[model samples]
Target: MIKDKPIFSVKNVCIDFKVGGKNILSKRSVLRALNDITFDLYKGETLAIVGESGCGKSTICRTAMRFHSPTQGEMTFEGKNIHKLKKDELKNYRQKAQMVFQDPFSSLNPLHSIYYHLERPMKLYHNFSKTERIEKMNEYLELVGLVPAKEQGEKYPHELSGGQRQRAYLARVLSVGADIVFADEPTSMLDVSIRLGILNMMNDLKHKLGKSFIYITHDIATARYVSDRIIVLYAGHMVEWGDVNKVIINPRHPYTKLLIAAAADPEREGKVELPIVRNQESEVTVWTPDSKGCPFRLRCPVAKSECAEEFVNAKQVSENQFIRCIHD
Candidate 1:
């Protein structure tokens, strides 16, 4: 059974990037990719990070994987601070945490065969002998539904279909014996017919293999299908989060409501439109440190003067759900 305790924790993490100034003579400025972002990833559960493009969904996944360091706050794995680990310790940490990139085509080496790709991780992390490696490779290949493992092993990346390549990537992730998998838009590039199959594979990995996953996607429908908990992000800030069902059925934040309403529904064709707040239509704004009050106040229909002047505090609305809104 999955534990209720957190396996990974991101506490008040802020990520900043130094960008070039408008003019050559002007000073450089900082872009806040993430602002005070905090969440816990529990064992054997899929935590879905859903938002529009550039809302820092990928940024959070990268930060969790130790690809990017946070300017402020801390990230811990199994009670150890990931950012403070030594070289050897960091290597060990990586063995437990792995990432599946969006594009399967680019992720795999065109020159190498599938067996070579799968065998390398086993060799690196487990230090298995050549015979042992081949044996394990076949086993993992079959485990991911790539049957007749020996035949599939000899094929290069280009020989495989998009869905097969993705499956191979998942097999590689398992070969490393990863406990946590960070999947960034894993199904965005695939055919619509195959997307569900990939999602089913992920579900099997989580439930049958007992692996934890961080699924980042813009598709709210898919997010709801795959996640136990959901976090809604806006302008690098967590607008709403909690049990997926609770948050989706009863979204409290104006931004969260907007996202849910924006989900694609075939039956509602031509009838659906972008949300307009208080007769005032607004577009998504870029993140800035100088902005005050709520980051979403500009587009909030129920926003008040206080929302534009002070930072909003998170309040527990349900058993495991929290919202950062004053009105709701």
Candidate 2:
């Protein structure tokens, strides 16, 4: 279904972290984690945030879920400011927006049985009776392809495989009646053979149950497979964002092009890490954050004097597609 209304709207959101000891704390010790990020998340669509490890991908997810308050700007969920919500309201909002953490093993409670894990949410959120909770838990557990529900229910997390644990994590999200799932590298730790299974399950969850997913990952190939739209982030800034196919086939930003090329290399017989290209001095990686120019000017191959100016408009390359670079 095409959602005319965006489930979540992030407007010029910026986050900062204070470094150094309490005694050493100073105004100069602030580190900008996110710099004026703005985006819209449509209902039931899988939007992938792809970036390198330190590029603020997870920070965006955490901030969107209201795990931390933003230093600047705001995030609206269902037309309400998430940051301003009080205890009761925030708890209610937390139920709607649940997180599937990166490590499946770490996320699941090792001591609790699978049934205990799923049933607790149903009991807490929906207040289902013992009988009803058990029944509903089985339904969701089986929905994620966890067979022999009776036997699996009694088993602890350590008893299950990695894929099984991941499925259990998905089942947990369903148990809470989560409308939006912020899956931060959900399958990054799984075996290569089983990663697709988890991704396929996420796809099925979106299509069948109509759940919106914010998939955060560095693997662009997996992002392309699972996301309807892909956002490319670099050094805490969004360089490119749009349809997955459009961005992959025709990358507009140099950073995006490099990311795509590194993730998927048709020229190579087998997958290999793309060589890192430097900008001028090899000793230091430079960023022109204060310059009135494109954010990617340092690493851009086609850099020019004109590119040293701010990009006010994102060009419409095609329907449902836009790019921020004037050089594009």
lDDT of 1: 0.88
Q: Which stretches of candidate 2 lie over 4 Å from their true place?
A: 21-28, 266-276, 279-292, 306-312
Overall lDDT per candidate, in order of appearance: 0.88, 0.82
Screening candidate 1 with a backbone cut-off below 3 angstroms (N, C-alpha, C), the clashing residue pairs are none
The candidate 2 region of ten consecutive residues with least summed lDDT is: 282-291
The TM-score values for the models, in the order shown, are: 0.94, 0.91
Give RMSD (Å) of candidate 2 vs. truth. Answer: 2.8
Please, what are the lDDT tens digits per residue for candidate 1 over residues 271-316? 6665666533357665667767788888887788898787678899
Find the 10 residues in a row with the least total lDDT in model 1.
277-286
Q: Give the lDDT of residue 93 in candidate 1.
A: 86
